[model samples]
Target chain A: SQQGEEDPQALSIQEGENATMNCSYKTSINNLQWYRQNSGRGLVHLILIRSNEREKHSGRLRVTLDTSKKSSSLLITASRAADTASYFCATGVANSGGYQKVTFGTGTKLQVIP
Target chain B: EAGVAQSPRYKIIEKRQSVAFWCNPISGHATLYWYQQILGQGPKLLIQFQNNGVVDDSQLPKDRFSAERLKGVDSTLKIQPAKLEDSAVYLCASSPPVNSPNEKLFFGSGTQLSVL
Candidate 1:
């Protein structure tokens, strides 16, 4: 079973606009990370936010995590056509043995039209 | 640095046949993972390995699926008597061992398998 679920299964926006995607999870997490996939290919790590952190930024990507609500959101500012891809949120859960395992969300498909 | 590597980018086989896929993790990384991604869905972790030891294989179907990482560098995943439901892309990823709660994962261009 997947621990995280992404909202807005698909989003379409014009180039230069901002795209926002949200993710909700059911379990406690040590951290949450977002990734981008193009055409069902390999995934590229984007950014990660720790449980103690509320927000993080990497270039044009901004991620915010609300542990109290068990949800997170990714915002891509000034989107480009190249930014068209599927976005996923993965949760790292602290296991009983102290190791962490990642569980991915269903993902959001974002299309940035030029 | 070279990213995770996977072989036989594509495969087609009939049901009940056997097939195997290979993955070579980034040099010096200690964590390796295999995930199965069905079309239009998220990737599901099938197994995870730390060095040459198995960390988790609970999601893997033991009856038909098996994997091993020899020498803690390269790994292989095999399926005996494949089923149509097994058609999906197999992704290999590796992460460095770090105390941080989050580790960036490098993924390979997955091998797409089609079982007829």
Candidate 2:
């Protein structure tokens, strides 16, 4: 079963605006990572926030995790046309197999209009 | 460093035909994964491997799908008598050992399969 669910299945914004995408999960997670996929390209790892973390930032990306709600959000500041892509959130759950099993959420398709 | 490599960027076959996809992960990575991404949906985990051993494959349809990482470096996923609903993008990813606390997966450009 998919562990994460992202809201606002699609978003369109003008360049330079901020884009926020939200994700919610049902189980305890060890970590949550975000990835971006350009059209006709592969997934690129964006940022990862551990369960103990409240917020993390990388470049123009800011991610917040609310363990109490089992939810996370990704924010892109001053977005550009290059930021147009599908965003995904993946959860890492510690399985009895002694490793973290990863599951992905339905992605948010973001379009940055120039 | 070179990223994960996947072959046959696209494939099309009639239902009930057989097909195969291959993956070669980044060097020295001990973990590999195969995911199936149906159009308009998130990628779903099909199988996972640690070194040459199967780590997780609970979601794999054992009756039709099979995979192997014989040498622990490259892996292959094969489907016999494919179904129309099986059409999806087959993605391959690799990550460092699970002990690496912040390990991230590197993905390859997936093989897009179209089962007619």
Candidate 3:
């Protein structure tokens, strides 16, 4: 079972436009991570925000986390056509035996039209 | 640094057929994972290995699915009598010991399986 659920099953936008996706989780987590997966490709780690962090940024990507609401959002500014891919939010929970179990969300498919 | 490697980019089989997929994680990584991803859904963890030992396999369907990590470097997952529902992309990911919450995971391209 997935621990997180991403809002907006899919999104489409023109090139140079911004894209925003949201994720919500049910349980407390040690951290939350966002990943990108191109068609027929494996997931690529984008950014990670610790539970204590409220916001994080990487290049044109910005991430915000709200522990109180158990939600997180990812924003890509001036998105390019290459940014088209499926975005997923994974929650990292500290499981027994000193291992971190990261559970993924259903994912948000994004399309950037040129 | 070399990334995780998986073999047989694609596979097609009929019901009840047996098949296996291989994975070689990044060198020196201590943790390895296998996830099954159906189209349009997120990847689901099937098993996890920590240095040749099974850390978790709670989600694995032991009746037909089995995996083994030998010498703590390479792993293989096998399915006997595959079902159509078993068709999905099998992904291999590796990570170093997770002492912190900010650790990153390295993933392979994954094997696309089709069970008819």
Each prediction's DockQ against the real complex: 0.64, 0.65, 0.70
Share of real contacts kept by model 3? 0.60
Fnat of candidates, each listed: 0.52, 0.60, 0.60
- lDDT (0-100) at residue B87 of candidate 3? 93
* Global lDDT of model 2: 0.92
Interface root-mean-square deviation, each candidate: 1.6, 1.7, 1.2
TM-score of the second chain, each candidate in turn, equals 0.96, 0.96, 0.96
Candidate 3 local lDDT, residue B40: 85
Which candidate wins on DockQ?
3
Q: Give each model a TM-score.
A: 0.96, 0.96, 0.96
Which structure is stronger by DockQ: 2 or 3? Answer: 3
Candidates, ranked, DockQ? 3, 2, 1
- Output the lDDT of residue A64, model 2: 100
- Candidate 3 lDDT over residue span A1-114, tens digit each: 999999998999999999999999999998899999999569999999989899999999999999999999999999999999999999987656666788899999999999
lDDT of 1 at A90: 96
lDDT of each residue in A9-91, candidate 2, tens digit only: 99999999999999999989989999999874579999999899999999999999999999999999999999999999999
lDDT per residue as tens, model 2, B1-116: 89999998999999999999999999988889999999888999999998899989999999999999998999999999899999999999998755486488899999999999
Off by over 4 Å in 3: A96-98, B99-102
Deviation (Å) of B42 in candidate 1: 0.3
**For candidate 3, lDDT tens digit of each residue in B1-116?**
88899989999999999999999999988789999999989999999998899988999999999999999999999999899999999999988766654377889999999999
A69 in model 3: Cα distance from truth in Å?
Answer: 0.7
Where does model 2 exceed 4 Å of error? A95-98, B99-102
